[model samples]
Target chain A: MTNTENAPSGAEIRLEEVTKRYSGTASPAVASVTMTIPPGKTVIFVGPSGCGKTTTMKMINRLIEPTSGRISIDDRDVLDIDPDKLRRTIGYAIQQAGLFPHMTVAQNIGMVPSLLRWNKKKLAERVEEMLDLVGLDSAVFHDRYPRQLSGGQQQRVGVARALAADPPVLLMDEPFGAVDPITRGNLQDELMRLQSELHKTIVFVTHDFDEAVKLGDRIAVLGEQSKILQYDTPEAILQNPADDTVAGFVGAGASLKQLTLLRVRDVELKQEAITARPDETVEAVRRQLEERNRPFALVLDERDRPARWVHKRQLAQASSLRTAGKPIGDFVSTQSTLQDALEACLAEGGAAVVTKERGRYAGTIDIDTVMATVQRLRDEAGVSE
Target chain B: MNQFFEFVGQRWGSLLFDLYQHGSLVLQCTVLAVVIGVGIGIAVYSSPGGSAIATALTSAILTIPSFALFGLFIPVLGLGVQPAVITLTLYALLPIVRNTIVGLANIDPAVTGAARGIGMHRLGVLTRIELRLAWPSILAGTRVSVQMLMGIAAIAAFAKGPGLGGSIFSGLAAIGSKTAVDRALAGTIGIVVLALVVDGLLVLLGRFTTSPGVRARA
Candidate 1:
């Protein structure tokens, strides 16, 4: 909702007047393009073939030298640095995994680490850990050659290989493109999960719009010759396109697309002080309760964070003193994404209470907030009842 | 029976000695030709836009008539194995150069892109990824060149180059005798055997260098 320029400063990667012109070509493949990618975020470049999205991403890691302009990583000019040494610190993944045909999966994933000369024991452990991180069984894959794996499996190996050395920056160019649609989706989700945990600054190139929306913390929509038409969060790009090019690129239902981008935090949550604590028994809770008719009471830990909810029906099953002092951090955090919050609700097998770290209660979001946000987004998009 | 046994006893030692000497010369021709041709072939192949030059040079050298090229070289190098070896090496470059380019170009772009993206410099990418991926095709080219050179090297013996060609020239010098025809036939068989053996060896080298997974797919 706020201008990105005015947003808090972060570790940024910037490209200024970047251009790539192949020999014998009339024009530069990538024109004067300038953009920034914040640290610990996923930025995807999406466009049709020949649009220069791939070229732009390649320039970040010096895979393709630009004809002009400067590219910087973490505020340092990339040209001043040695390309190979610079690339060693950046994670890169491509379609089909490109695991070394001669190397086994383990060796492929261990490439960067091995190059960095990490001790053998650490390298072995990291390789196995990466394999497991990408959901591959190290035992099954560590010794297996790249050819033995299927397209999807090869891509999983690719991701693990890219992240092997845990570089601060990652460059991925359609890393899942070779796989079938179903597998691609799974890999996308896996990437999202990985990004959440690893928080590496990532530049992803793809031709798929849905993928950009699903994975990108920000999406840079480019036109012919790799000109950026708009670079913004999915919601902003969808709901408030910068120009006709961006509007057309966002396609139909751009309005409702904004709603999908909003999380539960965007909607109001029910907040009240009338809640019980982990140490409070049902009888004592009832005695101290502000309203006896309350159908559900929030449970809190010592830090006053919302924990699990206790329904009146469950009160009869609980002993007076036994239920007291049970820490409720197992309950999900309030700041979780809507989908995660919904999952937590389902996991609780009843109403889910939102809590913060240190057991502070942040209030609960019910089906109402979820449905309202969904309906509001639908209405804004002009969807019929 | 007495004449045949006497003939065998009389020529057997010389025949074995000639076979060993000529056999080594043929092997020498094949190896030298491949080395020279492949050396020039890689240069031409690696040239940004010099394929036409390689083609022209090879085709023109091939057109001079194998004997004529040797004849032209004799005045300078003097009648020996030098001219013959040089001609065979020239002839071998076309196939080797053409195939090397094809192999390098046909390497999956994705693999090369991945190599670069993974932090490999130009040399690293070339040696580790491109060369390895293109190994089979390059070796295929080498095989074609070696087989062709083996046959050509035998013909080189006409210009005083060693090989079974010596026997053929000797046989032709005594054309009126039926024995001459028999000797020529034996020489021809030897040349064919040399070609087959070299070809087999090149194919084996290609197989050894080729990645097992790529071979299985092929």
Candidate 2:
């Protein structure tokens, strides 16, 4: 029943002069690649197939023996230790889940712990905890076999199993590649949520740059022969790619992708929004709107939350703010990203989107404000786009 | 048909004894074959050449005439159940060994890689994951071996091995006699019945021993 809250933080992973060349092959699969992965961060290796990204990852856990070069975790050489023993200290998840069809969900998750000879009771508790951690109910899923679960569920169990022992490092290779697009997006979000709590050092490999940009704390965009073209934060990489090679991988929606990284709360809110109580007389609201030279004023309920928007022309015909102008349906939350804010504005067909904090009216963000903020930040960083 | 019933009624005691002995001989030989075959399969399953050689050798043994194989064993093991059981065990090896190898080899490499990546030693992965996943195919091999050897065990009566095969050869030796067809009919019927019963038991065994996950697939 030891709390993971007190567990040791993730350890640093370092690869120095790492290279792998299969026998009988003229060129090395991965050539002289070296990178330092900061502790408790997720670094993704993204490139096209045959770029040796997977081979490079396999060398970290020694699944594939390195031809030459040094790989060290937390400053200890991986080759210096017994591979099996070293593997027990690291978590590894792969595509297709690779769950043992002969084992129950609980048994699969408890495998490493059981190998370490954990007592049955302790193992059971850990299995339940892992199932919960992955958002699966232990009561319903513990005894079910892999075939009994859906593909997405099976992958969740795979992740739970990898994290069962709470290993400091987790290596995942296309973990969501087999699922449908919607399910893949959900799993990606789930992994992000889990990483916020566990903070394990993760090396995720995928051919999809969008996924890398979404999940990676830092992304290593690799080119042919596993050569790393650029390694930097997702925003930095998008705003300032190392060269045309990296930019090609980043693809056409570079600015739009960058907008996804910025949250609605990241920009300054326009506090100049005119507002009136629901019971306020139309003449008073019209006077206030006129004073501000604004066309519309938000009608607020008793709790200071938006009821509706009242237009200056409607105020002339209406007695109170209660039944004036048009009702706004799309309200963006403070936690929503700038993309969400822009989408909300477009969906509502309004010039600006209202922001809500804890169900109360916070402020508003116009589409122009979002674009201006993004452009200003890009210029400040001296990025061309 | 009446003559067959008459022969059975008169030799009812010995006939039951013959059936029991037939069951024992087939069981013993099949069990021995399973152990040796599965052992060899596991030992060489990892190597392509070794697996090919082992499967080919066992399969070659099956192509040999049963009568000749029994006779060949006579000079070394002599008559009675020894030569008979040995011959049956040899006949049983091909299916068991082939299936065991195929079963182990067919397991998804991703599954084994995951097992190894999760820190299972080679032996642990083989025993706990690979073998368990391969169990259904291995059991199928065992079933084929058991049924095949049951008939082969009847042929073992050429060396005077235990079982109803003795009755069959004896009836054939008396050729054209009234009781000849009766005895042969009884022996043939006995062999078929025994095969059916053994097969039914194996189906039950597969159900009971196979994991629910593997069974769900079938």
Candidate 3:
């Protein structure tokens, strides 16, 4: 089996004057639209229903042919290639997972690889590898049918199937829309992690702006007739939407949504947060807090995991640091978004949010630091908000 | 019942041979109908006009009376199993074709779209995805056709076709004879038993061939 780790980097996709007008319709579903998708980055086509976002994405793989204009992958015209061959080279996944019911999880994942005529051993190995990549235990899931798995698991298999043949380009249309909100968030994170490793040129279509902002490296905010109002980085789109339509799509809570785009680790952590070990005496912790002139100290367990926050006043009244400190109600991880960190701070009613790495205390981000990072990003992007 | 048993004991060999003939004729006609019906079904199901035309034509064939239908075939194909088989095959086509169309049409468009989107050519999508998902419905049609043909094959005896239908028509011709009731009773019992056996086998076939995922819906 060929190792996907050695898979080629994504190919650039370009659309020039692309237009699709259904017969008997006065207006083209997709008017003359042009955009260039950089290799190895995720670009999203986001718009409301009937905005032709899905039609535009399908045109890339030739699932829906453009009535006029040209689409090319890596400078090669898609029209020049047979659609079946073109589709095999470009992975596609859609909502409801669309897994073949008669096939087991392994067969579904190995479909593209099998189409490429990989041998039994190679196909089996690829299926197992894909199952593992999607965080499913191959032994438990490979033999199971799609109906036997939960909605989230089926979507994971859908993604695994799309990546089976190591296609350099992937097109996903509302892939996680059918799953629950929590599952959707997890799947989005999984895709982000996979993208970081695979670097496949991906065209993602979704009506959800939050999803677009979270997953897309660049977002194409589309309007009626598939017009791209703004084609820029998520930060740029969030900071400065092109027009009222784009801003309306961005909708309320723009600042909160912007926080989701920045990770907790994106900002430098303030390490001045004094800490006391769980086994430490309250008197000693109080003395350390007094010496540092800090009102509170974050308590750490034996393994250096964040335990609680010890205040000077609480320590003065209690027998030990472990007993005096308030229980750690919420914490954020390095991989967690700034929005998560802010939420943690708000939930804990604390000025700072503690960061954990694999259950071990990493550092702390104060509310001021989070706001500063947000302000800095806005300023860098030349947006007042 | 005692008279029927006595008749069977007196001519057990001939009776068994007649049962075999009856089974074989029904099997042959059903197999032919399945092949042609499913073929036509797959061909036309993709198009609304074609499906409607195919369905209408087959239903029109079904409305023909069995005696008249078999008689019409006799003039062209001659009086024997050929006419019997042809009439039964014609009768069988309607159910199988209609069910095949329904089964294939009922498949979720997303399923077909996904198959095509993932690079399956038209033929591959049909064979691997659509047909597989539609198997239960198709098999159901076949079962209905087979049962319907089992009874029709008996009527084929009027065309001098194979099966216990000969015993039935002959016995009916001589109603008061000692063996008349016995012969007709055996034929009728054999047809009912054969239908049950064939239906059971079809149910088993459905269970065995259908994928666990598709079957799980039930």
Model 1: per-residue Cα lDDT at residue B2: 58
Model 1 CA RMSD to the hidden true structure, in angstroms:
8.1
Q: Write the per-residue lDDT of candidate 1 for residues A1-385, one digit (tens) a residue.
A: 1225323222469999998999999988999999889887899998887798988888888878899999998779999889888888888898877778877788788888877889999999998899889999977878888889988999998998888887878889889888899999789889988887777788999988878887899999999999988888886576667898777778886644554465655767777535866676678776555365665666765776554556566675777433533334345464566666665656655445766666466777666666677667656645421
How does chain B of model 1 score on TM-score? 0.83
RMSD of 3: 2.4
Q: What is the clash count of model 2?
A: 0
lDDT of 1 by residue, B1-218 (tens): 45534544666676556556665665565566556654555565556567667667767876777778777888899887778767777776666666666667666777777777777778878777766776676667667766666566667777788667777788889999856776676677766776687678767876777776567532
Q: Model 1: what is its DockQ?
A: 0.42
Model 3 per-residue lDDT tens digits across residues A1-385: 1335555579899999999999999999999999999998899999998899999999999999999999999999999999999999999999998999999999999998888899999989888888989999987998899889999999999999999998999999999999999999999999999998888999999999999999999999999999999999888888898999999999998888999988877888878888888787777878888887989888887888888887788887888766776888888898888888888877877555555666887787778888888888878888544
Worst 10-residue lDDT window, candidate 2 chain A: A1-10
Ranked by TM-score, top first? 3, 2, 1
A347 Cα displacement, candidate 2 (Å): 2.8
Off by over 4 Å in 3: A1-7, A383-385
DockQ of every predicted complex: 0.42, 0.80, 0.84
lDDT of 3 at B43: 94
Which clashing pairs does model 1 show?
Answer: A278-A325, A279-A325, A304-A360, A304-A361, A305-A359, A305-A360, A305-A361, A306-A361
State in Å the error of residue A186, model 2. 1.2
| Per-residue C-alpha lDDT of model 3 across residues B95-181, encoded as one tens digit per residue | 999998999999989889999998999999989998899888888888988888888888888989989898889989989988988
